[model samples]
Target: MKIAASLRAGVMATAVVALATFQPTPVAAQQASPQQTVRVGIHGADIGSLDPHMSAQTIDNVIHAWIYGGLVRFPAGTIDPTRIEPDIAESWTKSPDGLVWTFVLRPGVKFHGGYGEVTADDVVHSLKRAGDPKTSTFASDFASFDKVEAVDPRTVRITLKTPVPSLLGLVTAQRGGYVVSRKADQEAAGQYTAKAIGTGPFQLEEYRSKQFVALVANPDYFRGRPKVDRVVYRFIPANESRDLAFRAGELDLFYGRKEQRWVDRMKATPGLAIEVFGPGELRLINLNTSMKPFDDIRVRRAVAHAINRADFVKFVGADVVSPNPSVVPLGYLGYTDQVERFAYDPEKSKQLLKEAGHPNGITIKVLGSNRSFVEPYQLLQAQLAKAGITMELQLVEHTAWHAQIRQNLSAMVVYTAARFPVADIFLTQFFHSASAPGKPTAVTNFSHCDVADREIDAARIEQDPKRQLELWHAAQQKIVANVCAVPLFDEDQVWGRSTKLEFGHKLEASISFGPMLTEQTVLK
Candidate 1:
């Protein structure tokens, strides 16, 4: 919760080693042990929150996916809109007008830790909780909802303010869609945020803060018994330490570095299988339009033109990285690259800065995380320098970056995230005026841009697909021309595991943005 006072040495995060913190002195490999437990390493100092609705960060969401269930869900090990299957809901129906939906809960579904059976009441409560801005970080995603009610003991109904692009997407297992036990939440009071209770195949056994979490398999899990007996999820904040732990066989699977050199090195290690999968998180550089130099469009354009996206794509390696040309992530429904983009032109950058009344390049400060973004920012700082711009970085630890950015503490922000593969979801959260920082409905609109507010609002409810696409395109064009943010790269996640582990399903894409561990995940 607090940023450590000391600064880490300037090096790639994957090169900073702390052997004593992660490696075991001497022990048998976990894969060969009799426990059938898989030990996984996480990239955080500690979990930010366990409350499913509030788990907006990648690591916490990894834990949430194992603990919670949704009414509808993307298939295990993949994120695809067409293949959504039932989780808590056994059957569902929608009204003719598409404004109302009803679902029948699967019988005998029980919450973790003796919370008793999941009911329509629990579903209603969970959905409503997700919609409450005070309780959820993704409240804006549920803006279309009108009401939710328990139709009966097993049936629940949801009424929407208007027809959304995809009703099932909202209720599927991601972000605000994850359901929690109403009884458990009420009984636990404030304790529910720190410890989760759900009906997934795994249940929390113990949580030693700043260390690790032990989760035992749910014996009565609805899908079937979990193949693995237990999961030991450990927090290894440093990439180098986490990698050393994995290489030493202290961990069965760990998050991998998404650089070409690292992936190539890991591939050479016998028995290690590296997986690079999606949703490709778009790493963007947001220029704070509400602040001083950034308020001028020429300055914003100058800032954007100074850096080259190709340099980043090459640095990260073409295999692990996907180039993104627009503000919206590639493959989203309304994605387009027809909009204007400021290309990498150093001379043009200086000219624009001069027109904006700054002959000498202006300096901007960014608060970035040492663990997640130090290398990228360093490369960017050098790139900007060529065009007479100076980017000063105030480096902090990983968790602090998430906390500080929300408080609007940085003039520029280098943020990376994989959201629901929908244009409206990404646009509304990062581009909509309502989500601007310091506002009542603040999400992560770090740019404070309002150039295309009318277009964004109109597109979300346009109903006609063709017309909606037009509106969405117009919005992107406006935002690009205004230079609110520079689209960098679509970063596919990297993870390494022992080949002896079989994850039951094919690794393709995961809405969780990490490898999806399911009931069938097993040790071969």
Candidate 2:
């Protein structure tokens, strides 16, 4: 989500005062007053539900951190390849057979309302709920287990049907696995869609759709209460409007990257700061390989060579978005830089189109949404036109675009996937041949390419880390060589904050709002 840049000075001052008095806490004489409220600006419409099981978008994941707790977490001060840290599960061990895994839970961790202590039952129930097809969770991929048994109050053993080397990494994913309360699950199964109950540091106080969602610190949380008393996430979909709010001081934080103009403006304004991180995500056009025209590798390659990536990055105002050779990005383990990428040549693209039996011309529709992707979509349209490919741009609302893409109704659609700490998650989730085309399942094989079934299968069951990496790299090479999907550029997760908000650089794949928020963040 991108933060808008139109904050006004007077409004910012007023908002700052409100935040200053939000939550009062005792501190040393040298410490400044604790920040009571932190107003966050999000760039999309409110998510329909807060249930971690059902959310698939990045924005939804941001809210999930506040309402839910995972078995493990990517702690602050880590980067690119995130290191796992203990959360609810204090520590865990794997058996020699590689089938049974046991976890030692943190003692005295209680649920909301001072309910019973967190236990093995909660773990079993959460995993079972995630694997259930009716629950709509991506966790089904990792939860296809033989059995989940509670050996004791604080101990749980999970037996897997097959060896999964990346199981822990999967569990750490934002959407995959979260330990939900068994008591709450049974009592609120039907009503849990809108309500959330977890052991995280924050509790959801209120949710106002398309307006804002409020979260208060959980005083009884196993980890101490958050430094900030309350966090208010406001959903502002328009960029210009959001920028206005940021400048006006109606917002304490804005979820956007620094454009040149924004960088200049913020530099001149005191108390406001702009920060830039590496491009850890990719913005690309996914062609439905299951359909015509795209079924031909030459056609796909032609489309890749048609557009100018450099120009697109400049238009988008991002820092370095070059053409990627493979779906697996750089900095990933087993990432091979050996694959060949198509160079920009509109003339060559036209010739390839003619050779592919499109002697006259190829008419195709590019599908996209209007919220955070409008700028990139416009840039793509302009570039594609120069290649002599008659393009029909279909601009739809976010909901409609998601529906159309799932149904495989578009010839091509603009999509972005965040950087996964492990490459297996990206490979198995998105490119696996067996993944169903248009559904809410974790299978991201959106292009509907069926050529890599055997390769993906081989990689999934390979227990040896080095061997699995080799197989995955081989699969990525095959996809790239065929131009199955055209990659545009990597996107950085950007946010704007007050100068007082001090935090370390986030890990490349880090998704948490701000790493410093986890007990480590302190007010200057």
Candidate 3:
């Protein structure tokens, strides 16, 4: 599980050209070819973990979604989360006050490895595990839940401490909402990853370290058996190796590099296509408010004015990314243009710095990862230099960077994420005082911006969608006014696929997981 140190640019460039110029095999030859398996060459050395509640990495999430089933789920074959469809739970009803939610479990759905039928007890256990801070990464999301009870073998009841309008939407999530067999989990002890059991369309067959993860079609899947018999996700650490594999027809699909030049080359390649989609990564610059110079709002504002987001976007690739005006993305319900306040103005930044008693400007040391975060922050350094501010980047390993940032060590933090499905989840996790750097429910709020806490809480229990959006929008305005963060862009994800594979739905911009690869995905 190591990142590739180098990519053979010359070899990959030649491979891309050769693939683009080459002709496809004859239809007769293609028709006779066996296509029962879909092999994907992914850009990763290894996965962190397969435990759905524990792992938060993109690669892990993709694998978990294929092997897990939630009580309720988003639309099949699509990642758009605007609709909620029944999965393990056939139907559900909520009380008028929204305090109680009861779900009727579907019958005849069995967990993998002969664990027995999934019932209300399994659902209750799974949800309780997710709510426990010791076991789940999404404990904060379910903090309002008072208790969960199994009314009967097929009925489960959830009682909340307060009414949450977005409770149903939250339960449909893949991360914390997945239901695991309680018996299987206990018997496996700590070996749950090896004997992963779920009622999904696919079952984990093999997980070879630094090689690949293979899954076979679940014949007893409640929905229906998958069209493809097997799905393989291969780990190719080097970019050139993945490109070479795709060109040689050894791999059916792979994640594309986030560069327009790479995308253009792939698009020209014969028998290959690029899929670009979003509500993508919300790129933002987090300023530690408790830190030295940034303790003053003027300093934060100056830093915000110093950044030219368009310049940063150019380096990341405009074809696959767009500017995001607020913490929330455009496709979501509570998105607003509040971030437009900090338009690129170096003069204003210099003036603000002078007023803040730093006429010569300040040099801030930033701690960031050597991967995606470094390049953008490096570009940001040059941008800030225009206003006489010097940005010194301290390169650290990805895990160390995450750990250090949570300790409030960085002057500014650069992060890119396709966050939760709803605005409340995003707002609460990132801006609430409860989620501040050292709080009990601390997560990603490195900025320690607690001004929007009231508005965020108000939105959580608004009940009316229209009024809820207003509350969320007001919170965004407050964040901007305080200059807690400088949003760079909302990036689109790019993937390369062979012509032989056809996903039943359009490649969806997913926030919960990666591209949809469900029962309907097939090999042509």
Candidate 4:
């Protein structure tokens, strides 16, 4: 029986209602007996390239957060670009034109494994490397780079072709900004993949793939000695096993399920505490506009109408999930909700499908991650099925799914990501035509979108904040009207931690997508 639009909300609520019945057992006691060693249960089974400039996997990025530092960095537990603090670079100054910028580095900052103290040459080399398309996945972020040169051993200079809203964000301990050891990188002879050696509080000690990566405290670290003696980053992909290990006291911290029920259950556990905050990951289904049936705009609209946004809000719980009325993530610098939105109406969806000459309905194969993402994909499959659209899901390991989707192997892709919290960061990489998959400088344009290229490009160098926001708004309006991708909800980051652990700072926002173990973090 087809699920009518009137009954869609009820059906969606039923999908997650069973999960609420699951209650966690209250622990008799919680212990911090291990002293300083921290064991973390990551959601993935393995790490992707931790080479800073290449990896897109959340697992690798979290690892990068431990072993690397940038000229500037987000304060230990937050992702506020406005509150950036100095790391390698002690201070910086920009010329009147806002094109020429110079950074003065702190002297004697040592690299891991004795590569040598950081120098202007190292900063120059790393920045230049990040700007090179062949060497970095984040090359698109540095498009305005004109040149980077060493002024002296203590200073480096960067010249840009155009002004940006916040240059500090581009060079923070983010995507292409984490500085790698120039000497170590140069001598690795291509063995540098996932072997990150930087000036952070922890240094890589051992790495046994698919098992664990051991990191030891860096006594010579500029940030001071890490409170923990060692950090064991374990790879346990199964949610049940990970949660069991956490509850059994085998792990200090672990990634939790994103559903509200799981969070509430954890909240009820006496020994467990939940860390939920921003930068929230936005989940969206990118329908390949260049592919067969989706190439027809009417079919795209039909797919859009098929999705019931309210159902997702009800399923995830309003507090854990919020409506995304724009193409950009909520709370982003230039986010605007003045755009197109397709209301849920099954009859209109069917009519559109027939109008597009698909009276029998259409079938689409989709690539989905078999990790925490499985739930969302399952929900999506059920929703599409109700609209007479058959969604054949090919669930693969998280890492493989990340790789395959970049190759544009499927007609539909549901991607979850939280980038630098800027409108331009999401716009240029996600919706711009130049960043389309199969292109030389591709980041992620899974839908092969090109509708808003004009506004996206214009917003990059608009200069005025008001005019820039206008450009971004125009871009989102165009993209939504064309149904390039269905903007779903912004679900904040969630992690479960043992109450025995003290992360030093308050558990809040993280751009790394997981709790970062720093020099001050410890087992209470």
Candidate 5:
């Protein structure tokens, strides 16, 4: 059964406007045209501030796409041919030894305040800030860079401590490394949160917490002024409210509201369009290996065998979803379908339980947050019953869930990690033992698998592309074999927009709003 809730209070006026009587309403029609401002409905708030380094959520990343322009930007759709489009840095070259990377900054680009021309100094400062553990910038993935030096006004060189294959992909990330103005950095005295100054196509005009973030087009944008005059991102935490707002015309874009009934309705709607892309984002039940019950591999494997992935997919709509068998989704490079997912077998689960010395029924607490994950937990509760496994479901708010997960308080938790461009990022961030307990690593290896440490270390520095792939595949095989987590379906991101808006599916799960806000979008 599909479920949805409105994240906001009042009814969106836009929906009512459509139902209003047609009485010489040129202003209403004109505002509804493509020329007017585009309102986007997001599931969460503006994150309390617009600081890119503050958090690593998808919302923050989307905001950064406008506030700052990175050296490179991943184009929408497909990672195989791995397109690297120019952003702040137009082009770059790699040294023969692969230790040094030199990037050529785009000339004539200026910061928000009409500050002095952007140069290599800005790039160096940005990298240094990100690498500084004190600053706590989200670009720690590139923290391995030994030093960043300005070779020339337009050229900056990054010297890596070791050869890293995912370097290029890292630079394109929203938090990876964005060139910031030296003047702005010094003026803020290292407290640049809540304020932004960069060379992207949009400039932050105003940010009201829990309400909306307004951005105006950048006249001197290196890529050229964006088509839309102003972009408004409003938080609609409730799926029902967001859907209603979209239908009412209050929002031009909607994302991550995946109720099957809503998708079916939108599919039949004449003016709406749906796009599904590959490299599925895996939603899995993360078992805390540091804790009891899950600490045993046999118990974890039994839990994995008990859950029926096919039924779970069917319960959720499969038109835009699929069961993710491996940590790395299909269609990605080096992703082989060889990982054997444990099929649903009550007898096998019971036998494993007995072998694990659980002669009596096993009771496990399944934790989930919000509606997005509740279905999976509910299904697990029912399925585990067949194997004499007593599963208790706990539904908590998002903030509380984060707190509990960090404390490793739950036996099993439903969670997801956004897809990265390379497999190394996945391996190093999520499975590495060094990042297991205390570090603020995104990998959040909550599964606490100690064996993952050696494999992740090997994969991180494996220079040969083929060797790296082999190492990554081997590491994933180990994780799957141990049943660290039961992989489930990729959540479909659905958007409802006026016929004017146009954007396509992204190979990487990260959403890019720049394409849809282009000037080419016109109203009927």
Candidate 6:
């Protein structure tokens, strides 16, 4: 159901009644032990898609990670790809020329639904599917791949157009890396988004539109069966409603609120543990330069100077959120002091506005989602108003907001994202003109800044790691100079879990969605 953004209060009241009536599944009761099921509450109203290759949103990637396996994977509960280990691929070897990579598949890894053991052919098909633009929004992530060939029943070789130092890291990431079963994809065909069968420890059991998604442990999983017999992700869009369900014991874990007061409140709640870690999401405001008004750099810079970062950081706790110094956030490489060039000066803002022929200031309409984006934008609206600029917000459902932004409808776009690890990934996806909206292979270039396109393209194939970073930093500086987008802050990833729950690895940080549920995650 599409809940109106303005109807959150009404929905919260009805949601409580509905949640109170929610019964524990039979699978939980059937288990002899208490550690049978884990129910989680998240902020999204629904999953956009579950197909491993198709789903690019963090909400969807979180679910996909559980049901899919990649050739190589980041260590459990971690985000850095440098520490990656073998998954479906037992091991791999690189050619002396550094252009060819050969991977050896694990002998007995089996796909769900009796599709039988995963083979080299499946790997070839999966990579090819990921590279196909029509099938995956992140197909560009694999643009370096020239060919993927199955050398034998157990070996697959991937040839690259150029040696990408971050190739392994890219292949181990959630987007283009996760392997999907060829047999399952073929069987599902038009129904792939709803159905998924992979080599992971959990199998998709049931998916209820706009409500919840249920998964059951895979008994024949290669590593071992998941300790929890069932996992249920309930879609609770309202922050207050999610907190309510979590406090009432309907949810064992839930996504935490970003506001300072809410975090403190949850921290005081007994029997609850809050985990906040980063290099997290970089929350940014993308001013549509392709459209009128924002098309002018002076207007874009005016919008930037009118806002107060100190107020924003203070509002959302300074402990949890930090100032983003560049388009490339703090924790990532290639981040520089380029952001210092734009300071929070309302006087400068008005001057720029005057010079641009808007002495009385201008009003811009912005579209955003209610869950997380709206709160920040509302604060921004108030901040901008102080500088004589008006920010008019039109709120919509999260999914609809995403659809609208991609169509370039909003004058100003509010987005928070955990980008791909490498600097090139962020530059190409967000700054390259080829990936901008309205382009043939557009993905997330919401700002439509094309000046850095040449540098971003050059950085993608730069072999020297240090020089690659330098190029990435230069490209970012260009974006900053153009005032294409305002880098607000990078907030820590926060989640509240029951003290009784244990995810085998340390939940210190993750680049994926949340602390992932591997075969070892279990309820105490």
Best by TM-score: 1
TM-score of each: 0.92, 0.88, 0.91, 0.90, 0.88, 0.91
Model 2 ranges with Cα > 4 A deviation = 1-35, 77-82, 257-265, 318-323, 438-442, 503-509, 512-516, 522-524
lDDT agreement with native, every candidate: 0.81, 0.67, 0.77, 0.79, 0.66, 0.77
> What TM-score would candidate 5 get against the native?
0.88
Question: Per-residue lDDT for 292-392 in model 4, tens only?
Answer: 99999999999999999898877887657788966788878888888887999878888999999989888998888776567767778888887889999
- For model 6, the superposed segments whose C-alpha errors exceed 4 Å read 1-35, 96-98, 338-340
| Candidate 3 backbone collisions, by pair | none
Q: Residue 246's C-alpha lDDT in candidate 6?
A: 66
Candidate 5 lDDT, 425-498, residue by residue in tens: 76566666655756665436364765656666776777777887787788888878877777786664445555
Q: Candidate 6 has which clashing residue pairs, if any?
A: none
| Residue 159, model 5, lDDT | 94
By how many angstroms RMSD does model 3 differ from the true structure?
Answer: 6.1
lDDT of 2: 0.67
Which 10-residue span in candidate 4 carries the lowest summed lDDT? 1-10
Candidate 2 structure quality by residue, lDDT tens digits, 127-175 = 7777776875575476447888899988888898877756675555356
